[model samples]
Target: MLVFGPVRVIHCVAMITRVDTYLHSVPLSGAVAEQVGPFTLFRSTITWPYYARPVPGSEATITADDIELVRARCAELEIPLSFEWVVETCPSLGAAAAAAGLSVVEHPLLVLERDDFRPATADARLEILPTEDDVIRQARAAVNLAFGEGGTAVGTAGPAERDANAPAVADGLVATLRDRMLQGVSVAAGAFIDDGIVASGNHQPVDSTTEIVGVGTLPSMRRRGLGAAVTSTLVEHAFDHGVDLVLLSAESPAVAAVYERIGFHQIGHAGAAE
Candidate 1:
């Protein structure tokens, strides 16, 4: 069920290089692009609401014409323009992106691998399950509740109320999740207890690496090791499917600590805006 690859741990710098190469490989669908000065511009359905950026260090200058070209392409697609810049490489792109009227969303993003991954202890007693059938429904509810998608508090009634008032929206979101799971666009795992899902996470695979995303534990369920279980389980799944490396971004130092406990090491920071 898996391909064989000699397992060798990768360093932070090499990992960043691989990430840049990965971006250029992303298939651009039904979109045209051109090189404006040192930067590259491409439009694609998969990268909706944003134009694509070349790998960091590959470009150095951004001209007014470059921004206008991006604007023109975005306008043609009837979507807004956006750019992603990794500070380690593209120091000038941030100012350029800002000048283009793109509101920058900057944060410290940590990268980790399985070598640094700390496994959850067995005594946690949480049943981590693959997202399938009804598990998808429960996992969807768990993610929304844990992430406070419908309200400021994790356990608030907003998610439930929204489900009740807008059944279609909720159902649509869950259905899309299901499709993504089935299509391998994402692999989801959920930790379930007596009540329902308490923790959930996803792995987004691109080429040789899989990105751990949406690793959230319900507020009430935190401090019990459920988050570690969800993350470890997803990492295992990605490896089983032949992914050589796994990466994720922590929202802050505190959150990064939680991931570090599970063997993920901080590599670098990334910037993006939409």
Candidate 2:
């Protein structure tokens, strides 16, 4: 609310709420390859809508021969691709996304640096423990609160307290992760407010990168430093590894502001393609 400078809506986020439109309505919907001119265009609805992995120099092809040839080759391989400005994490495919008329959607990070990240109530003790029980229980409670009952789905849910619910990693909707690590419970912390698990969050570590996701606070604990404290602890935990940058997406602008105060920038948007 007070952290971000101003909100920007280059596109209406509500457009893709249906969960099946883009993958079904678009021309290239789910086609492995589409024949257009000499180019065989491929398509897929994975990760972000406009995400891609391009073949270097090959992606730089502006000439009819190479460009068209690569398209056909890609089609033969049944590879579907979406174009986003490729990062170094990607193969150095020269502006293929740009060549395809895609622009660099700002990948935001912490716009500010370290500031005093204190909780609203210092009376309660916030402790981080390496386990998933707290996160799971809080997640279940949050889900129940967000939805009426039996609505445990994840992602841009109507609002944590409206009628929808928290967006989970799908396969493990009740499982708490994207991978198949059978990640028992989880590694997390519990924030005690007044008394009991008033706030809970989980920070998962992958190799060297860690993301402090699975944040949930009791209804009575809303608008407090519980989320901030849980997040900051994980951040400091990640910093122990000398992490250059920590990134995560926030659906609520109000909460995003809190992260901003702790130094997080809006890195554009993340879309779920049905």
Top of the candidates by TM-score: 1
Model 2, 12-53: lDDT tens per residue? 222212111222222232234444432334454332222222
lDDT of 2 at 29: 24
- Segments in model 2 whose C-alpha atoms lie over 4 Å from true places: 1-123, 130-186
Collision count of model 2:
9
Model 1 regions more than 4 Å off = 1-11, 23-51, 55-57, 63-65, 121-133, 149-169
lDDT of 1 at 157: 38
TM-scores of the candidates are 0.75, 0.45
Measured on C-alpha atoms, candidate 2 has an lDDT of 0.43
